[model samples]
Target: MILRAFLFLIVVWTLPAMGPWQDCEGAKACDLDGRSYHIRVPDDWDGDTALPVLLHFHGWGRQGDLIVKHQRISGHTRRRGVLLIAPNGRGRTWDFWDQGSADVPFAAAVIEDVAKRFPIDRDQIFVSGYSYGAAMAWRFACENGDGVTGLLAVSGTLRQTERCPQAPKHIRHVHGFADTVMDFPMGAGGDVTHPVALWRKALGCAAGRRLPEWQVVSFLSFERWHWDNCEGGHTVTLDLHSGGHFIPHGWIGWQLDQLMGRVPLYP
Candidate 1:
């Protein structure tokens, strides 16, 4: 199955080859500021299925391809039934919130545009990212989680929770304990807020125990933490033990599949 999927991506990449989506047989694009996002077309895409959608944001110096490449490519219209979108940043690094209101608007534009063009299910819309990209996800979640089911925030810190909106929504955070760039103990002090603690407080799960459930990828120890009893809803943390800023292979696919529930596995 892995070989087939790998070959499938290989075939996709071989076509019209530009960025990773050069051969994305089911992709579309929008060029702005010289940046292009190669969107994938689900094998089962009917243009009216009201399926779910995922907005994938990349970290600093990264783009949509980084997220798409890691996604479980499906010839079907959706993955696990959800339509996934990997939006490239005009600046190669997204500013979903921060001071770059322009980027945020651009992101919002992409979300709306895709939903309009595809049969995206409104209730299951989701956003996810890594490192700086995670920071951007938090920004969006803080501002838009009301519309989204939840956020798959990974390997980065949040901005000052104090400056964030008054009420937060369902949030799933995945952080690495040994991340030197964004350490667990530094809570925004390391340029990114210590996400887990703040999220726990916000979710009203500030007292949950730290459960270690994870895996090792490329010799790096990684794990996830959980904090139940959230205020608005439920929340989980994919805490990486010795993980770094990069997203591991297995978890990425799992996340995409898990959230895109009912979406057929990428064929």
Candidate 2:
């Protein structure tokens, strides 16, 4: 069931505070740099506890609203009690590759604004994206590692640049070996090796160790390469899947399980 990809934007302000949590269910407006980003919060939140937040970016020409509808993200956010912030790109595309893109500053502001309005765990902030959005995710995680707890990039890789962030962080990149749109090994869609090498070098890892087990979910199977014993709890992982350009079913849960240290279900 391939869902149509559409991207959106929203801007929001603080809402009326309830007993313990603010009622932030459904779509709301979030203002950053005079632009509005549409954000979704779960209604079932207890309001008293600080929850992790995920900033999800859509692929090029896709809207934030469409990502929630198509990416199976809303269900994940609801069940995980995660605050989701999906911001639209200026022209349905993010300028993250450009060193001077305003999207970076806007993203930083959005995080701050969300924290001010909700009970968000600052230390557990996450960023994720697909395709072009995936590139943006890498850019953000690379440049602002200190502010991000982890990042997940699908079907894309980081843009070549002068330098990478010195801060240690966790990173996961998932790519389909059969992808044709982004072209798995070449083309604009980044291959797994370069990004992994980039981070390994930055983290001073002489080599990456291979995981003992391969993970599988339905028709999707992946093997992992991990950089170990890096400074500052920094971990770099690359999961190469035997699939295509589209996001596979259960992909979100699979990555989340990895993040939470839960084993992926194998068949």
Candidate 3:
């Protein structure tokens, strides 16, 4: 009995510790500029093809691992065979308010590292965010247009761009009409309409066309707008939901569809 107990204790002592730093199976933990991030590869991946990668930013007061563990975005990513990466922000919030912020370089570094370590499709790189992260996504999309193929923004508006981007990008902005947190017609950092207008102008859209209304769910109505005559085949879509102050259940799926060129008239 003493011999058996000794062996068991030895085995337990040699086992690796399960901690917050440990990533789940098929996921990796990465650090850049003293910040940490979590990268998850779809379990269903064929292990041969170069898959698209999505960099999803968390809202204020949230960490990358929390988002990876709790957010429904991962489900859509897995179904679509896309690699999902969640980055931690400085001080539990993104630093988009600063020019040439550390977050920018950290974002670039994460992409660089992920591309080097995984089978990333450079052309299909996407960035998405919620709330404060959403604002940061817009900023990155505007400034790093060459690196990111598209942007998925929710529950936040962006600051004005300093200059026009060299390439036009596809952007989908979704928000609730009754949101009190970020509030419709956004109070601080500019209203919701500003970024849409900037994107239209930056994309060189000659005109804006409103699409027909589609009711997504009970008590949830939607209105969409498309920018016409954008350069580089780029387009922008705005989805206004009747629900408020929360990420809609279907929004992530809709975003994946849009990125895959499977956008439906009603989503």
Q: Over 4 Å off in model 1, which ranges? A: 1-28, 31-36, 71-79, 96-100, 166-169, 183-193, 216-222, 236-238, 256-267
User: Cα RMSD (Å) between model 2 and the true structure?
Assistant: 9.6
Q: Kindly list the per-residue Cα lDDT of model 1 for residues 23-89, writing each as its tens digit.
A: 4423446554455654665544444457676677777886676555554232222445566677777
Every model's TM-score: 0.71, 0.81, 0.81
What number of backbone clashes does candidate 3 have, counting pairs of residues 3 or more apart or in separate chains? 0
Give the lowest summed-lDDT range of ten residues in model 3.
17-26
The whole-model C-alpha lDDT of candidate 3 against the native structure comes to: 0.72
Task: List the candidate 2 regions with Cα displacement exceeding 4 Å.
Answer: 1-25, 160-162, 166-168, 185-192, 261-267
Which model, 1 or 3, shows the larger TM-score?
Answer: 3
Which residue pairs collide in model 3, if any? none
Candidate 2 residue lDDT tens string, 119-198 = 78887788888899888877777666677877878887665443675433687777878888766644345545654666
**Candidate 1, poorest ten consecutive residues by summed lDDT:** 16-25
- lDDT (CA) for every model shown? 0.59, 0.69, 0.72
lDDT of 1: 0.59
Leading candidate by lDDT? 3
